[model samples]
Target: MRNARRVILCLGLALAASEPLATLATPAEAFAAQPQVYVVRPGDTLWGIAAHFLKNPWDWPLLWRRNPAIHNPNLIYPGDRIVLRYDAAGVPQLQVIQLRPKMTVSPIPSYHTGVMLPFLGSPGLIAKRSDYERLPYIAAADDSDTIFSNGNRLYVKQLGNLAPGTLLRVVRAGPQLVRPSDRKPLGHALIDLGTAKVLHDGALAEIEITNAREEITLGDRLVPETPVPEPHFFPSSPAHPIQGHIVGSLSNFPEMMVGQVVVVDQGSDAGLVPGNVLQIDGPESVTRDAVTGEHLTLPGRDVGSLMLFRVLPEVSFAVITVAKRGIRVGDALRSPPPEAPKVLGIAP
Candidate 1:
């Protein structure tokens, strides 16, 4: 338990030091009734932490106060101290103090672990046919080996001279992705096979598999490893209203649940970027009106929410953050409704 007077003194000092505090208009009731100081632990995510203190996790951006000097202001890591305080106007806010400031690698704020990390770090889809076909593939292996695993040497043709220590991602091309609404082609999906290093570079270069998610077989394509950086972002509504649908699943599953990645038809062209949260609705159903003998179309019920973590030209990859019911391909999505204002007194 915190000493009441001591906490009061700490707040007094923090408020005194935090000069020219920015005035926020977010309602006090949006915050937790008894918000406490939280220390970020390993495996903790920004979404999970925000959901701990706010009514809606997407409301994080409104309540979070970031330090602009940091490389990635919104990416909080383990050991950081999160403090909750109210301004003179009684508007609640969340602030953080970095405890481990010298760490080399800055971890991602959203979907950093479990099933979503691999998809985020690897190639999930390529939006162009020419781009997919231009990548180099394994032309031959030692002794004509049909399948290779970690630590096995292989030969790749068309891999051009570069360097000896470059890392590459092994992938297999899958079926073409299409928009669920009009069945228009979007791009081709890529299956992440594994990671490999360049022992030699040039046409007919020698390489060795360093990691394998699936068996690295003959003719698997190789593309330069995509660097996954800590996104300078926070969950917020899209700038403009967006209407899209779940076109496909990254895992090729018929149904999707929380923490699973799904491909959406809207992308950069639709003004979407990382950390944009959207609402999900089921497909509309047509029914017959008994009394008037008329056919009626009823809109789908609000099922859940999703956040965009990866965006391309015409499509983007999103993870299901909330699922009220089963989510599937062809389910409708739109900009989340505005948060309803609440009137409540602030209590410490």
Candidate 2:
């Protein structure tokens, strides 16, 4: 069932119809200093606004919980003002002041759906990684077909004695790349395609695809859904140093920008945790030294920032929250020091 949209009638300060609107305070310490009022600007998003106020874009889910007064966060329109207030306990709340024509932006599913579906490639997002295992690989299609889609019949091996109606998520082993340091293999990139359900039980199983975000080819793997990692994690700068590379991108666009998801070779094993913000550095710019007739290669500067969310053993996925320019594969990743300036080129 579709959940009912949330609604809240705000209770706070009122102004004289003739009084000029107040100036909004936006210092980083606005919450500690005084009540901060932010007028929503064009191209504003809940995700982007959260990063602007809280320095943590993915924490918009937390902000949603805190701001029971702003129902239907996505309904926020350009020119609407947001007020940031804190309680005695330092708990912050954001209140939306609707003073303009109501406008709604892109729809984002509830929290879990937003995080899980993308990394898993379930229905809405492109496949990012793939996991291969010896067992449970697709053996054949019901009609000797090589390709499959939602509602197509498939026979999968190694699902021994599974009960009817059991469901499985399809995956594929994407690629194997080695860590440059010790020549150790970073784990296989696992691509989660869609889901299937069992119809017959045995050493092997007959299953029907219930959904397919992408084409399911023979040799794709299957996994029982349940242990999908917890999606909510506190957003913060990395507690320690983190270094890695932009191993891949799922958005498929040759150029990526804010809100795009990128795969990083760094993970928990490398001291990376969810919400750890990292600076993205682009390729070095090689320039010619006019007088010396020599080549000068300048190091890449911080082009943007991304927050690590889903962590695998050797890799993690992060969404770019700020970008001065397009993000690319092979960009270097580095953890920023605490209180470091984060947004590059984008204003707060």
Candidate 3:
């Protein structure tokens, strides 16, 4: 009896190992076996629609194979057709071959001056001092250390080789400014002091400086500005733009300002990148009930826009160039709306 039981147990184990186990059908398998066509609708995002047929929304990018027509990949419009093709092994594939209206990229010119920071590629480089630090680094144009008695004149410890008629900027030094919500420190704002001319050069240089707008004082650090290439702004597509709140900024360099860094809530998971322009909008107006005195905040109105200059896996840096109103920390952002089509058929 024992020998027979052992033989039966071994046979059961072999059968369990050899036979294909029963499992739940994946969304792709289901979609492939029973294909359904979904028409593109207004206010529908590809990420949303793809989620219906795919277990992971990020896998949507894998659907298109060598299709050049879909350049932006984010702009799928209403009345467009998105087909779901299935493979012989019962796997669904999403193919967005249909073309829609093309979105034009808005062009804007801007200038920037700063040193190119060294890029740390790997952890091994951190131990090597030569890989981490770069000499002759560009510093901010404004640094001073004169004791001011209610005057704009700035005194420096040493003028070095500063010549006459050289341009300079005035900046204040204090504890690094931190973001109120996230406790991340942003670089101090540099007040442009117009230009300066060296009157005397020695251990200290008595330079005649122009106070642009803000007050100048003592103990401000003075440094030379390094000329760098200007930054360009690239607008996003009309269909999909990201929206989020500013979190913090990066301050690894002296001239690098963190205020320019706009930390939105969206990230790589949302398909964001450097050079993508996002339209910034302010908070919605608040509506109050007359009887109970209760107030409701409506969706915020669109105000202005910004162009992302730099991007990270979770954060991005954007410059505010065309803000109708002042942009705050928690402003909303979206893709700029497409231009209205020309009317021709209707009579005037």
Determine which window of 10 residues in candidate 1 has minimal summed lDDT. Answer: 13-22
Best by lDDT: 1
CA-lDDT, candidates in order: 0.70, 0.61, 0.41
lDDT of 1 at 166: 90
> Which tens-of-lDDT digit does each residue in 42-99 have in candidate 2?
5444444545454434334444554566544545555566675544554334556664
Once fitted onto the true fold, the runs of candidate 1 whose alpha carbons sit more than 4 angstroms away are 1-35, 64-73, 85-90, 93-108, 113-124, 128-131, 143-147, 181-183, 287-296, 341-348
Question: Candidate 2, which segments miss by more than 4 Å at Cα?
Answer: 1-49, 52-82, 85-112, 118-133, 227-230, 251-257, 337-348
Q: What RMSD, rounded to one decimal, does every model reach?
A: 7.6, 9.5, 20.0
lDDT, candidate 2, residue 103?
45
Name the best candidate (by TM-score).
1
Better of 2 and 3 by TM-score: 2
Model 3 gets an lDDT of 0.41
Q: In terms of TM-score, how similar is model 2 to the real structure?
A: 0.65
Q: How far does residue 10 in candidate 2 sit from its true spot (Å)?
A: 21
Worst 10 residues of 2 by lDDT: 13-22
